[model samples]
Target: MNSTQQWQNVTWFEVDEHQDGQRIDNFLFSRLKGVPKSRIYRLIREGQVRVNKKRIKAETKLAIGDQIRVAPIRYEIKEETDAPVSDKVAQSLLSRIVYEDEGLMVVNKPSGIAVHGGSCVAYGLIEGLRAASGKKYLELIHRIDRDTSGLVMISKKRSTLKLLQDLLREHKIKKTYVAVVKGQVSLDKQLINAPLLRYELANGERRVCVSKDGKESKTQWNVQERFMHGTLVHASPLSGRTHQIRVHGLSIGHPLIGDDKYGHETTYKGPKPRRLCLHAMRLEIPGYAPIEAPMPEDMQSLVAQLRAQKADKVVVSDKDDE
Candidate 1:
């Protein structure tokens, strides 16, 4: 199959086993390079893109042997370029591999590096890994925000992708994160059950908010330590939704300490954190041993500062009258 062919005329794709269960929109995005997502959605909505000769939604999953037809659409050929991945970026990603097997590998993804290429980013962790390792089937099993450093799983085979994704959907895979939130949580353990809805701003930035009409979401938080102005907690999301933990923390008036979005930055008087204080510290799969990533140096420094502040306060309070 000529996956890079420009859709100057009608194009047909027969789904193979490798392509099975992939979303129709994603499939189109790969084939119809340089096309905007809005254009692709419009094509699907207007019935210009069809499966088995019938109109289908963007979320439609493709099955083996299914036929996809795309109507004629002229797109700029020059807009797409084969840019080489940077050696620095590729080596950085390869060195962070914490776990690897015949099926998949886990990477301790650093903050500011995206999982995949999109938006304005030319290439991300996955792209760099693919380029460096020469692996064709590497795919993200789950995603963490670009600013949130954590352990991310990448599948080397399609079957492993399906299995791990199914485990994530069923909540069988446990993911634990450590975060420093703005307020000292009174409760030792708490569960925030709030639904989240994703919306786009007028400027086209995507954001998530807690809305009653949104999808059900839950996050379990346990206070690990308390400071004078902040608290270190372990956050485990019971449901996967866009910005689930960040939004849920905001809903409870304890947003993450360094969250630019959904955070109370002005109210924080402590030293400014370098990045988002959330880290995917631990992951537990049913059949496999737990995978963990140590807290980054910056985060560790922030926690230490908080501890010092708490100690100073205790010393001041315990002093006798002057």
Candidate 2:
């Protein structure tokens, strides 16, 4: 116990066809009795959930015989805490890993899984990573929304974390995203330059809104494809602001198809999508060139289907979000 790295045993799990398309948290709860849904969520955010050595979406459809890697969190706590039932927690948590390394780890978070905890849950992705890695501490370099999925950047060392954070602040890091917008976009590309006002509630929950008196924000958007029914858009923000893409899309009158926070039109009508259609498609870090991750098949298929519908305007651009 002199070193920070400790190892604990975790049981592997199998997913039956009956639970084929269930969200990751739900599956974990059903299989891992006694584990709180919130704790399972924290584990998924921590990069502890893995499937066949790769990070995956919490709600990622499980194929038959999918193997998962799970480890219990062992903390040198200031106070005694209840230990969870062992095998049950392990079974649900081990199925969604895409990749991991000492330098960084990438996780495919589900649409409903928040990257961190807040008013609803006490622990978040950062807390979970510390437990899962059994390290003194692990840090997140960046985060996707609770409902956004795709690659997330994590750092094992504070120095590495600082380097990445600096790069992001200076606009050296580039994040690429794939999304479905509600309307057709005429422009091939456009930019949104808006300001954002961020508010942290009393309970530490945060929300962003557009205010003329807010901080500057910018978003560049391109039309990847336009469908008959809607447009598929690719978005990249010059600045990282909470719900930047979602709010900007709304400001331009074409909200992201499934984002309830920003899609006022769609939300009023009904749930157009089962999950938010935002994906952290790619990221460019400080390196020889850049690292790019492709969009998940589900989103790709969604765009392809929309194209078949012959969308008139398919993408949009908004400057900022709170």
Candidate 3:
């Protein structure tokens, strides 16, 4: 392998402080521009990509001074596959970045943008960020639904990713969400414990339901405000399952407003909301200052409307008492 202008056929990377805590797969994505993420995973699986002379998984975080072996392959930046991001989308992603440091990036991901590309999505938030920043090891530590908007953590260091993932599994990191549901919540506080199972229907659509044979799931919520049409509540899922909060909210008979899957469209009163009225409001990491994402404009408007109605009721009660 020649040490020339072009990359070597098989290159060795010595992880420096900047590279430490970055996942090997993400590192490769940075180095091998134009390569698809799926291909990168395949390389790791086939042992073409290795660390310390042994095959490593894509999620393997590099340590300082670790040596990585990157196998060479025919590479070309295809126009169709490497379609350029529009300036509008690029700027949107750039402006949404809330916090960024050596080890992590927190973004207020917009609703309707998938976290990563797939499911007929040509490119999503992560891809947009990668193109905008040109960083090699940018990776999502957790995911929020495409219809859900809020703080999303992108790990820059492999160590941080591992640590945060561990905390999530143990339910140590606190995540709070605010949502508007279809009916008035009678309980100020309630805990819903149920078992959830996911299934795919004949049409290949996926859904989750509470079943006796499913994994345990729990959601704790308190009514923030009651409305004639619906309820605004603060909800936290104690267990992480796919759609855990959404499913649990549905099980308790207060499906989130704009929940096309588990909620009845006709049940919601007034003008229909433009999007799902759910937002990832805040995140409390064990060692960092709590991060909060302001409610997006659409959801904020709906909540404000509900509040005004509640205040009107109060005024009417006062008049009657007088």
TM-score winner = 1
Tens digit of lDDT per residue, candidate 3, span 261-295? 87654366644688988899899989889899888
Ranking by TM-score: 1, 3, 2
Model 3: residues with Cα > 4 Å off, grouped in runs: 1-82, 310-322
Instruction: Give the better candidate number (2 or 3) by TM-score.
Output: 3
Off by over 4 Å in 2: 1-100, 200-205, 266-271, 310-322
Instruction: Report residue 225 deviation for candidate 1 (angstroms).
Output: 0.6
| Cα lDDT, model 3, residue 121 | 54
Alpha-carbon local distance difference test for all models = 0.82, 0.64, 0.78
Candidate 1 lDDT (Cα, 0 to 1): 0.82
Model 1 Cα lDDT, one tens digit per residue, 2-105 = 12435487889999987776668767765665565556777887999999999998768788999999998966443334546777767878899999999989
lDDT of 2 at 269: 30
Q: Please report, as a residue range, the 10-residue window in candidate 1 with the lowest summed lDDT.
A: 313-322
Q: Quote the positional error of residue 320 for candidate 2 in Å.
A: 18
- How displaced is residue 123 in candidate 3, in Å? 0.5
Q: Could you give candidate 2's per-residue lDDT for residues 1-322 as a string of tens digits?
A: 1223333468588765443333455456434434444556567767788877788755454555677776675432221133222443333223344556666665555566555543343345544555555566355567788888777776665456556667877899888898888766667778888898875555445568789988899999887776655667889999988789988888787788767666655532322466778888777776725555576666666666665553353244443322
